[model samples]
Target: MLPSIGMALVLLFSMSGCGEEDRRGVLFKGVVAPPGIVMVAGGREHTLALMADGTVWGRGSNFYGELGDGTTLNSLTLVQTVGLGDVATIAAGGLFSMAVKKDGTVWAWGYNGFGALGDGTTTDRWSPVQLQGLSDVTTVSISGYHTLALTHAGTIWAWGYNARGQLGDGTIEDRLTPVPVAGLTNVVAVSASTSGQYSLALKSDGSVWAWGSNSSGELGDGTWLERSTPAPVQGLTDIVSIAAARRHGMALKRDGTLWAWGANYYGQLGNGTRTSTRAPVKVQEPSGVISLMGGEDHSVALKLDGTVWTWGVNDQGQLGAGRDDIDSVIPLKVLRLTEVSAISAAWTHAMAMKQDGTVWAWGLNNRGQLGDGTTTNRNIPAEFLGL
Candidate 1:
């Protein structure tokens, strides 16, 4: 049985925010934690922290109480995502969020205007509510208006907006609950972006599948037609990790090569041109990238040497460089950032955590989403305090 949201908060403190050791920047290098902790960009206005103790902490925007802190309040301090025993993973959308527990149970919270919560109702949940009939959800991808989950058995389940067939259920009907995506199995990773109204999954065999909206060729099927079913992304064989942007998609191969497709109005595709491609094209970066993340109109990459690189729209200086007007067509190094553990990008904003346990943010700060206790937009990256 689920405990009351209040008691869950009390028990949550010890489990969720208990780990406060100074990370010498080698958490992944040592055997202390699992290898290559997954990082999702544009997932939430605030990031989700799913600790090993089965608890979740969220720090960022909470307009809809998506933080799962049992109140419709914004928190600068890390607050419990849920008062659950232990959570395995977490996925956050624009307004709603979901988590998979260690026991294969699923929980959801926040906005349900279109039934994104998957609780068999359209009512918004301020606190985490157990999802019905979903077990062993290994990973979840939350888009602007939809949600997708990959089960332990390799089956893909989808819910929320179907206006653009982003749900991939062979129909344009929005789902209030989980529905299986047809003709897909043995999937290793799943991701959804904000704009494209589509989803991508990389199978265990190094092949790529794309479905949903394709108006701007976000599906990378060489056609502008929308697909409600899974289709192969052309020229993208042997891909290992994939990322979706608001209007474009990018993938990284096992060979440390990066590829991009779809919308390129602001040079996000990094192909040294502003033209959009309907098929996968290699991103023309000279560096070997280990991690890649995309935001509303910008992208950030982590090179093999622990340095951060950024490109695309820098209207808000999301590139983390000191100058705002200087836009680079190619990847440029973000200054004052080093030994970074991970980085994430949001709308007109970028954030990173260092190996020394400090967090920094740059770009749009309209709602104080940067968490630096200031509403001023930063052209260069600034330190975020009070964590």
Candidate 2:
């Protein structure tokens, strides 16, 4: 869920009267951050942070203008995403960035090869642009080449690549503009696989619905057939949250139990086995989970105790278990981290936000996504300065 719209507006107005010099302190908003990160989003090779002041910042790869700084140059240090303020929440896709403003309008920028920007075009944007035909939007989710918007009225709108029907419009046709998702209503939250071939929605009744590429069982319907429309996941109820990865899916029950299905070649299922399944399987250890995230081939869980655990492929130290060349079939506690408030995982890197509002990252840093001011990878968690 996203932060309240009212609070975001309050913060934005409170800092609206600052002087020019004070505004110059922060590159994008022109106002210095209030020393805390309220939210974070991870992309394939970049990351975004939303400050307590309702401003957004980006770092790492900007090859496709994913950084949203009006340039394609990547930065190791944080650069404010120009023209974004009063943002309620932010999401990062494979090579794009999205934000929901306090006014309930959605904005997007970056790679739009398949019209992921939803602005009726396929041109990449170097800075934020108001997404056409969308308003009263509560949240936005982006994947490899598509996006989803959930409006306050409980309607879900989709656009972009639909080769595998990830758009959920009951068709395999790509859309350059927002299209209503067929037959889905009362959706409280939605998620799209970072790989862009599948999607999931959690309804008000706590039932999970899936669509798109079911190959590798990503749809969790006990079938490998692809879906052009929404279908109920087998045997899942009381689910509070859902996450989709490259070829897998995960759900967090209200009781803090984590369930995984789909691809398990690398044990992303976290069920103490490397075998894949078409049905949901219980994840091992640290049951009091409050949130969960999945990467290309790994998974992460944030327990109520504020500790983080990770499993699956660690070839790039994405698991943050002090090793980078091995895989863990079961969950392992991340080294030297605690008091975590939120977590995000991309294809090969992961990030955690401590209660103090400081962000930490580890794993692949070839594009400097780690934000530690270096391209060197860390086998253990490292503090990311500049909030």
Clashes of each: 3, 1
Every candidate's CA RMSD: 8.5, 8.0
Q: Summarize candidate 1's per-residue lDDT along 123-147 as a digit string, tens digits.
A: 8888899988898888787865678
How many residue pairs clash in model 1?
3
lDDT of 2 by residue, 1-387 (tens): 211111211112114786423443444444334567888888887889898888898888877788888876667778888899999999998888999999999989988887889999999999999987689999998988889899999999999999999998999999999999989999999999978999999999999999999879999999999998999999999999999988999999999999999999998999999999998999998799999998889999999999999999999899999987899999999998999998998878899999877889988887678989898888799988777
TM-score for each of the candidates: 0.85, 0.91
| Model 1: lowest-lDDT 10 consecutive positions | 2-11
Model 2 per-residue lDDT at 44: 80
Which candidate number would show the highest lDDT if scored against the true structure? 2
Off by over 4 Å in 1: 1-44, 325-327
Q: Clashing residue pairs, candidate 2?
A: 23-30
